[model samples]
Target: MTSIPKTSRRDFLKLAAAAGGGLVLGFHWESAEAKIMNVIHGGTVAGSDISFNSYLSISPDDVITIFSPNPELGQNIKTSFPMIVAEELDADWTKVHVQQAMLDTKKYERQVTGGSGAIPHSWERLRKAGATARYMLMEAAAKRWSVPASSLTAEHGVVYHKESGRKATYGELATDASAIAVPADVKLKDKKDFKLIGTAVRNVDSKQMITGKPLYGLDFYREGMLFAMLQRPPAFGTKIKSVDAAAAKAMPGIVDVVTFKNNVAVVGKSTWQVNKARKALKVEYEPDGAAALESTTDHDQIFKKLLDSSDPNVVSVKRKDGDADAAFKTAAKVITKEYQCPFLSHSPLEPMNFFAHVRPDGVELVGPSQTPDMARNETAKLLNIPPEQITLELTRLGGGFGRRLKADYVLEAAELSSLIKAPVKVIWTREDDMTGGSYRPAVRYRFSAALDAKGNLVGYKLRGVGINAGNCTREDNFPSGAVDNLQIESIEHKSPITTGAWRAPITNFLAFAEQAFIDEVAMAAGKDPVAFRLDLLAKAKTTPVGAIKYDIDRMKGVIDLVVEKSQWGKKKGVSQGFSVYFSHRSYVAQVAEIEMKKGKPVLEKIHAAADCGVVVNISGANQQVRGGVTDGLGHALFGSLTFKDGAAEQKNFNNYRLIRMKEVPAIDVHFVNNGIDPTGLGEPALPPTGGAVANALFKALGKRLYNQPFTKQEELKGVSLGERL
Candidate 1:
């Protein structure tokens, strides 16, 4: 029997003990793989060594583990990323297991998961990771059989010598393959040769998730760890004045109370006790007295003032092609409309939380974060230590939607743990997450179109005003290249209230406003909405236009697919709306169908078509499309956030409306496979949904809505389409 090394992961934990005698957490792939390898070998090779790479490991018993480097925010990248590797590896899907990789900047680049860039950024790298492994295995087999590597073929974790009728499992050759030199370049499988890329593979974590297993950051725990809850300023533009924690300290289960920055934190034995004590503590806050924070009403007036003003300080031209003023002056008719969208909260299912142990020797931080690399670096900066001293592990995120891209929660846990000199888990109450600001910036847009006497579009103009958000216009986006004279301008209001990226960012609401404006212009031009868009695309494809950012062919591809799939004009007695948008490098088109219920318009179904290149996993792709569309529709119809005196007016679901399960319309998803590299799917489908629903609603009600949360309009106020049904 071979002698296996005894210096395991647990032993290393003992090696890295802190000054206070607490164990410092560390992870090594070999030490962690021992138990898993044992199971695969049926307790035979429990102590045997395995061949592994930075991204993958192959046990002698045929268990192939692929490490997914990107953070998973329910985007299914965890499953789909590995599928990309497995497809190129030609590994059997049944023998594969996926694990989330810890933060290692040297091992993997771009670990962040926001902007739906994970797949597109990692596609080639992951494919090469697998192909390199397969190439090494083939080389090993070729050496053993005395045949050229070019003649040896690898398939489904096996190397075969077809001429000699000899075959060996990848497990049997893994040891030799480990010694083989990895080729600098290996051929990637053609898309048509893939068996797993387009297949509907089940999510690896589905069973564990459905069984209510402990997987998310909230579920993480450490021995001798204390739970913490924070008491932050009640409203934006406020700072802590005083803290009285005497009564809180007397409360049962209370451990200690401390203040950091401008916030008070309560430490206790249990979450319930910590939460109860946190609320019991008395904390006073005074006005920060910086720039006056703008309420929703203030933003409304500010946006109105900036829309028509050309103040050099507030307004700047984003893009200009030809002379828009000259074209508008010569036009026969000009149509103008203004649209507004309120601030929105991410409201992911899981509230913010993180676990941290700030030991002297090293730091162990674990939690759900969309940007784990940033969290690690920020924590290191806060501790005044090198980033390599920190070992950060990622847990499955309950929900992110770009909210976890910020490291405030993670930093809080790190700072609290450092302050208390113990392992700590910080938890945020639903109220805390909601009231703690990081909202989508509220924005307003004014669009004007000029038409010639022949009913052809001659010029276009757009001016957007946003609170705290910079440059709220996608100047190079669709329709920019289609018009002869175009101008886009942006105005910014520097409000004190904090706001950050939310899902699709500016395009989330911009798509709706722009698409709805296009619908209106189409009506004014006496043309069908779909035909009008197609005409613009055709002009963009053929005519000389100033720098188009989107692919005209892909946009038209999705538009054609959606039109064909939805039977756009074939359905009778049903009001239909059409919208198409290109965002995040992907093109999406949607058609919303509304059937009249009494006098109210009830959304019956939505058809979505996307051209995001090749679909890695059909099941996950479909889920993303459906989820995005549902989220977009719900927010367009009911989502709204307002501020009063620099404080969020709605704190919980009761006041902050979300679309009910009963309100979700049936959604059908289709993908256009053009054999190109995958782009973004998580957010592309969402941007067009609002426009589709709004356009359909216009047809149903014979009135155009210029603002979001259409329910806020006088015609829709207090009217529930669900209640009508």
Candidate 2:
């Protein structure tokens, strides 16, 4: 048995009253030297205190309840995190209950759920929590039986003295355990002894979701709550000039019409009524210098100008090693190509919506948010109230591809509720969500590579241009340290259109550009794509040039696994493309099989190999990988959010195409079996999907796609592939 580290004395466990008369336990990690204390104190338990920092509780009937601290945005953390605690506690899996914790930074540190960091950050702490509680329960049972603690063994929430044949249930000993002092140090179960950690446990909320239960933000409703809709500026960089709401206010079910800083608000009894009334309201906007902006023409000129500019101030060096210019000048052969991707919309199934009730005492917000603490703090600042006065309840999010990280929708609901002096639920229609700004920034990349006479890679240079958001290229991106002469430069182009993180952030475009260019280089060097990448991985593993952000061994691990699983070059009938990338501390490699159909590449299947460390829920992890692959394929095929005269051109799914079931292919996912701590699986699987598909298109059609949305409507109509090829 390996002993866990001892906590300091300042760390105390509080046993308080819980709802339904269960045992409520709260623990806090205040300092580095803090340890769980033994003192038991009694006081009137308030509703908030019942669950305040109360991660785990045992009921009188031996039922254990675990509170999940992180906000769940369909990542399955609610089920996975509880399994970590249950494994260490040796609790009965069937007897466990899971609940979502409120946003309280004091109790739960770093409650934000972005970057796929919840599992790694909470692994050790949660295991320690469960171990501490198990030790306390065993000690209490041993003391009552007048035996050495070593004689006791716990299994399935039962503490038994094997020698004396005396057994006590955890619920039966809860009262005594509450008074026992927490052990300074406790032992943790080894990986080989894990029962629930690696097991296939169903999602805690799966039943509720399948049964159409009210678990999402849009399902939330309160008595006497009014529905509100905002008639925002038609385009970016515009403000309200005048408003006319006479006919809107007179409409049936319409309550009132109000003007706000950016838009007009229509309040009514239902979402439909508010939307109907909002459509009837007449409003004029004052252009704010963005009315002349156009995505199709202006952005093309902007990117071209930036690429051709001689201003040194516009270009920033992100990474450099040796002399790239000299290597390129003296190279035996050089290959240069340019790639670009348009802006994208998240387009989550459930549009942005929130419910807020503001009063003199405090403000209560219930909705789906990726960053509840940030939303609460921002709302507090806007309302001129203390942060403590703002209460935020997180509901299950339909889908958050990094869009929910922004608290603008939450703040909007709070502001409207404050002005109306009533509980209000603000709903953003599909049009509002699609047309609203904060899209994924459009990016362009120019890649040049130099190779020696022996076909050995020597130099690589990349110059990237992104809109408004500075650089979309990472300094330590893949193949950075793999080459001796390498340079990465980025230029920023200002735009009025707001931009933000998409599913995988900059890696979404960066991986597509880098991997596609790598494939082209492999073709030019007369080497297999997989073999070429493996050679680079071996170089990075043995002799690296600079700081290596990724583990070379892990990179090789996934690539080899994917090559074997995909049967690269072994499949006789299908054309395949291979790609591997690292992001969010996880490595994923994908092989896409495609065939040309009506001059467009039709996906046949995608085989993936991932090394995200230990697998928590095999079923859920596979689902995530499949979903991510599908999302990446969908967007890469024909997804683009464009603008003309500062207004979004694609206002709905009809034009802004998403992958349908017919378009998605069967995905076979495999994971590396190792003892490494688990990394996030939500994002890493997505970045390589695009690259794999693009490479497969080239293999199938002998054409290189320099831009995204590789297949357009005209191309799909059996147009010749001669133009792009």
Worst 10 residues of 1 by lDDT: 18-27
Candidate 2, residue 665: how far the Cα is off, in Å: 0.9
Query: All candidates' TM-scores?
Result: 0.92, 0.93
What are the per-residue Cα lDDT tens digits for candidate 1 across 489-596? 998888877889998999999999999999999999999999999999999999947998999999999999999999998999899999999889999999999998
Which regions of candidate 2 fall more than 4 Å away from where they truly are? 1-22, 29-52, 290-292, 595-601, 713-725
Index of the highest-lDDT prediction = 1
lDDT of 2 by residue, 1-725 (tens): 11111111122122223222434555552221113322222432323322235357676678776667688888888888888888888998888887777677777776877898888787777777788888888889988999998889999989999898999888888767877776666788887888878777788888887878788899998999999999988888777888999999999999889887787999999999999999899998878864455556789888888877768888898999999999999999999998888899999889999999999999999999889999999999999999999888888899889899999999889999999899999999999999984798898889999999887789999989998767778879679888999999999887778888899998987888889999999988889998998898888878999989988888899998999999999987588999999999999999998766666556788999999998888888998899989888888877998888889999998999887777678899999887898988989999998899888877887777778876663323453432212
